[model samples]
Target: MAGSVRLIPSGFEFVDDVWGGIYRGGSYMLIGARKSGRTLMGLQFALEAAKQKEVCLYFTNMRPKDLMIQAASLNFDIQSYMNHNLIIVVRVAPPNDAYAVPNPDNYLIDYLRDIITVVEQYNPSRIIFDELTPYIGFRNIELLKDTFLNTLETIEERDVTSFFVVGEPATEKAQQIINAISQYVTGVFQLRKSQSKINNRFHGGNIIITPNVGHTEGQFNFKYRIEPFKGVTTAPDVDDVPSKYADIKNSLAAQQKTAPHYVYTQSKQDKNEREVFNNVYNYNDFLLILNNQIALYKSTGQTFNLVSVKLNAMAQTQGLISLNQLQNSVQLSTERKDKICIKDNVLMLLIVRSNPNSVVHFLSRLKSNLPSDDIDYVETVWENISILNIEVNQDIENAEELTEESLNKAHQDPGSYLPVNKFI
Candidate 1:
């Protein structure tokens, strides 16, 4: 029996960490939120199967064919497989002509028929449907689901493994539709966003794999990261940085002295040294705070703004003058504690739980704080921060050993898919 086929070498950390490998003859469903790397995840699996000299068919209804090809090439470097005829693409055009046609009800049927024809023609070992969300827009949900199930059954009988990418359900109705479809697939993998406790940044989501048809040798709930060039990668250790950035019980000590043009009315210290007021904090600390706020905002829809201020060389040469100027500006319109800091000579203001109107006012005030001669020269940037969720895979590092035939297949023409200019 062709029980399991390793899509990538076990030596590759991604294969070992995320998925032991995709099982042979498995129909999988990848479900994730919008822009959560669902399409990329599907493309990655398709590319891996194609690398084994297997015919792979990709079908997408979300993006244009040219743009999808461009993204696969630019982001994952998978264009060569398409060039070599190992990967075939089929784009499902939307029903723009449905309203004009005499028989508009046949749109779904026609679409599925076209897909089946392509699948039969390609005779691919692996098939990837870029998305299954568009079906929800159709009026006959039950019929579409029935047709989809029948299609999958036909593909399975032919020994062609398949993957279907579905957007994360937004409403109860959508969830019900997905639940109905989920029962037919061999496996269901949910991709979602998981915040890093250590860094407080959106690394990627935990992939929840629930095996259905095959023997459940390995299933997982693990964190994964979506990387550029390479699609998915195991995230760093969780405890790399403790979640201590938000432990600010008291304010950081203020400068002792004041600048000639700027004054800190809210400052505590009274030291005479002008150099003592260089308000810069460590860059890493800034990242920690930024990540923490991002996670906080994601959990609670409360808003926060990040304002970055970059000063020029003339301002830096004057020691604490630039720092005092920025501090005075931020303090005038923004909260002092837990709001303003200089990271690597750049001043960053964290407008906590504030809306857009107030943030704009704060930016204007900060701009006014700069020196009259150099006010126009200084650069200021601001953004409303939000959490980004990315889709990734699951893992089973020490799962059951593969059969000899499967192992032999993994080693055949190992680097055939690798370009000569792989480093490039």
Candidate 2:
């Protein structure tokens, strides 16, 4: 995408004038201490972007109706705006919603998929994420990066802009997450509460964009206030630096540098007499295959094995070469010929109508490939691979039982591989 011809206003005149507002196709972050008006700033930007004719996707944990009411309180009236497609509010509550409603059986994966689905369906020009704290802690870092962050590359390719709202970190670990998250975004803004009162005359709080995304110079030092109907406003000022900034010093430096981004594509890799073949599908697409197979099992009672394999390589090129070789093995050896899926370390194969004997033949064929060769790393050979599940003939049962018992077993148990006997 070309450099942003125009910028999306943050609904704050001071910020718009200084930092050039938000650039199109860029990812930005808004983090603040508790009650520092972070959500308000996010909402204000969504309203302003919508008014400027940008299709804005507003994701909030609040109920759709409640969020609309909140926006209306700030004079945005997002309901009508939503009716006209100017702004859309989607409720993406994390695990906390399990108490108020019946959560999805597979909550985390389903929720992430829902997010990607909405982005694809709406094709919004601007996306405002109200709060990312629920998903960005130390333990949840991989979960967030592996799923949602990857979707962000597609969002950038679409030339859409985004602002992620994050909560202030009270602990050292949480602060570390803030540092890690800053590198991925174009820049970060630290918002804080002021010692003064919340009245209009006094500064409501302060905000500063670290490593300013625009041409603005010097360390950002601006105070913000909440007007009766105008929402949050900013003005140039100086005050105690936000504690959040101290922890993310190195992170800001990293964002200022250049980095290479890798984009993964889905394409046909091999062909047969009947049709072309996909070497591997992403995990999300593989879910469709899994669901279809389960549906077919309900109808025809056919059995299949869910196999997960790993390849050790030092670089991406070597990994791709090994993956292609593995694909060749599957095509030449296995009874079924279908597109397999690989993500991170695991490559998944759906072996159809296969028993233990057939699985052994497939393994033997893979072993027949002999010692592999790769200069970038040690010889790239199969490692820690096993048939994770065998959905064979069983008594008639409901789909729900199958989902929780058979389908998710492999997903939950990545290390459940057992020793395999010699295929020969």
TM-score of each: 0.48, 0.51
Q: List the residue pairs that clash in candidate 2.
A: none
Off by over 4 Å in 2: 1-6, 97-113, 138-148, 198-203, 212-218, 237-424
Backbone clash pairs for candidate 1 read: 18-394, 18-395, 36-391, 256-271
Cα lDDT tens digits for candidate 1, 1-424: 1344423221123323334345566688889986566776777776556545566888887554554664564264445555444666666666677657665546656666566688786678888888867643445567767877778777776677788888898998788878878888877878876644315543477776667765244455656666656655564344422233112111111111111322324322211211121123344555566566666666676656554444444544745345555454455545533455553344555566766465456556544444343433443211111111111112211111111212232245222222111211
lDDT of 2 by residue, 84-178 (tens): 45677776657665335453323555555666688887778888888877755435555555555666676787788888888888888788777
Using alpha carbons, what is the TM-score of model 2? 0.51
lDDT of each: 0.54, 0.61
The stretch of ten residues in a row with the least summed lDDT in candidate 1 is 248-257
For candidate 1, the C-alpha RMSD (Å) to the true structure equals: 27.1
Which numbered prediction scores highest in TM-score against the true structure?
A: 2
